[model samples]
Target: MVAERTSRYNFTPGPVPFVVSGGEGVFLHTTDGRKVLDGAGGAIVANIGYGRPEIAEAAKQALTGMGYVAPLWPTENRLRLIERILDRWVPAAAGEAGLTRCFLVSGGSESVDTAMRVARQYQVAKGRTERWRVAGRATSYHGATIATLSVANHDRRRQPFGPMLADHPKIDPISTEAAIKDLEAANPETLAAVILEPIVGSSGAALISESDYWSTVRQFCTDHDILLIADEVMTAYGRTGTRMGFEHFGPAPDVLVGGKGLGGGYAAIGAVLAKEFVAEALAEVGDSIMFFTFSGLEVSVAIADRVLQILEDEDLVNRAAKMGAVLRARLEEEFADHPHVGDIRGLGLMQGLELVKDREAGTTFGGALTPAIIGEAFKRDCWIYPAGSARVPDGMMFGPAFIISESEIDQLVSITRESIDAAVAGLQS
Candidate 1:
């Protein structure tokens, strides 16, 4: 183990810090030679396993061929990647929604911020300048940027910056009626768009909504001329057994934002996909769209393109679906009756265990039990993501690489069960 040290400039140090030397497949190796299972895939980002030589080679080739290019200029790599995302990777459901244009960015936060700006621009182009407010789910998370944080409802992330954020209306994630009520109260005329996670992540792990809820929300947005934005940063690219998370529901979003698995942690990349009508509206009002300096950089685009190719060649999307079932089934069988486990929910590779003080009474631990649980899991040579807030209280998230085997899944579950018991015992002690 490494000793804790503080630096004058270090701002966001982790609770338990360790030095990692390298990773291969689904395990991370520490500098001191300890192997830990990457249960959460580093914040649920690595859909594909680590140490992929092909991806490295692709990036190298791109760097050698075209060192750098400005965002304004188009490159072959960027065009090819856009083509793959539009013609090959996009789900049929998203295609039906008329998503035909792509705007590349650096990461989830930038993608979300850009999407919000695009929504505002679209409304303005349609002569609805009064539509400026955007509604987000009360328990959902979009990203860390100012614009994204303003619209998102993550309590802890928004607590310190409350005064600086816009007072956007927050709707319930699970109830369409609550959303309708809030929208009505906010006055639909003032609302430009509504952003959703389809399957909520971070604040709540893989929290899913009913199909009817999505359908109703979609209808309401369409009827009122409010654009619907789907934040698929954590749920897209085979994480939920679908290319896009919104495909799980009946209706589709007018704009979709994706990150994380898009580059499989091999490159920093994200994209905002707009429907044909939405893009056309923006086109009508020329010079409304802006670009980031690093948007659609050649090397990153090449790496992302190769990642998509690997996913298709190995049929890893289907593997995620099959292995996800195995993982969820094993977790349920092991933890469903555990004393401290309140609920086990999620889709595909993204799963979460809600912890509670009294499972029968549906009571939460009410404090900071998540950090303790995460610490215990680390002690057991496993890395699991901890999720909690004022809304959710406590949860443990899991999103291993799609290549995880049956035996590895069993091992992960066993460690989690033991860690949960150990954590709860520590709390009592």
Candidate 2:
């Protein structure tokens, strides 16, 4: 028998414990033949779950019709998807999630890249060209590309590329009051826009902002003439039980960047939804026409169209809402007695469990705690994302597929409880 080389792939696979081969519902099959329940949906990207026949068929049909087309030219699928998206969000929000126009891109990084360009262009169009700095929230993730990386708060993700990042202002995520103070101190005149994940995803799944906080920030941006961008790449498309995360807020964002579940992980796609005013600014004074070759191709667009239809037909968004409540309730019931499980918070399918060392004192777990818990969980064939700082406590963020059932939801909560028990027991022993 001919022997193949045993050299393995060395790329980092985020916070996952193993390589996933396939998934059905919320269960993922790893290459090592382990079927682990996907509690976090692979960074909250797979909302629809794995192995969908309809989505597969849509992609196949597009391939048969026409494989690829550039955005410089027009295509039928692109036009249809754009019309469909505008029709859905525009009427629903009464112009609150004001994205009357859609600009497609390859993925989330490209979407954020376009967002930065659009922000700077908006400033230039309004004749505030000197407003060059981009302000981003600490611990929020935009993307991995250079400009987006510059604005991104994932320390580990950005450390290697630190030298090349463009100069931008950063605000700590302590409070909206503190953010305002920092922004003012960092030359508010030069600031073009402030971007944030309506719900923080990466850093401990921190859902610290209150209901009025977003509205206050929106008003502040308006008074200061800085564009507000809602980076819904992780929280959009029913992840938060709404069409958009900003729907939970008071004022609409000037730009809404969505990608992760935009195509439901069936295709690589992202889009920037801009207000009519932002579109007009681009039309009037912006010289650069943003275009990516595979941004709005036939296959990706067809998949997107079907994904939206499925979301509506199946009423999965509502499912996310119902399941989220059950999951949260179960967590509270199961882990209420546990000393390590500090706090649990989320919206819809997006939920997080902060594991601390002591409940009475609220002391956080150190760096060693995460790997121990994650390893123990993997042995049980359960995959959950572990995040947070050593200085602070650790937490697990979970946003399972919207189509998840009550049994599966219970399983998730049970597995987490088991993982926690095993970890704690090991430490105590």
**Model 2 Cα lDDT, one tens digit per residue, 1-429:** 001122244354334456668888788887878888888787788888888899988888888857667675667778878887888744366365556878888789899889888999989988998997889877667888889989867776677887899878888665778888878887879999999888877664645575666877788788998989889898888888888887877668888889988898888899888888888887787455478767786788889888888888899888888888888888889877777877788888888877888889876656556667777777788877776642234777888889888898888888888888888778778
Clash pairs, model 2 backbone: none
Error of 2 at 183 (Å): 2.1
User: Clashing pairs in model 1?
Assistant: none
Q: Which stretches of candidate 2 lie over 4 Å from their true place?
A: 1-7, 12-19, 30-33, 94-97, 389-393, 425-429
Off by over 4 Å in 1: 4-9
Per TM-score, the best of the predicted structures is 1
On lDDT, the candidate that comes out on top is 1
Residue by residue across 1-429, what tens digits does model 1's lDDT show?
244453333586665556788899999988778888999989898888988899989988998846779886788899989999999878877787688889999999999999899989989999999888899998888999888999998898899998889978988887778778877888889999999998888887677776587888889999999999999999888898877777778677998999999999999999999899998998887845688989988888999999999999999988998999999999999998999888899888999988888887888777567888889888888999988666788888999999999999999999999888888889888
C-alpha positional error of residue 179 in candidate 2 after TM-score superposition, expressed in Å: 2.0
State TM-scores per candidate. Answer: 0.97, 0.92
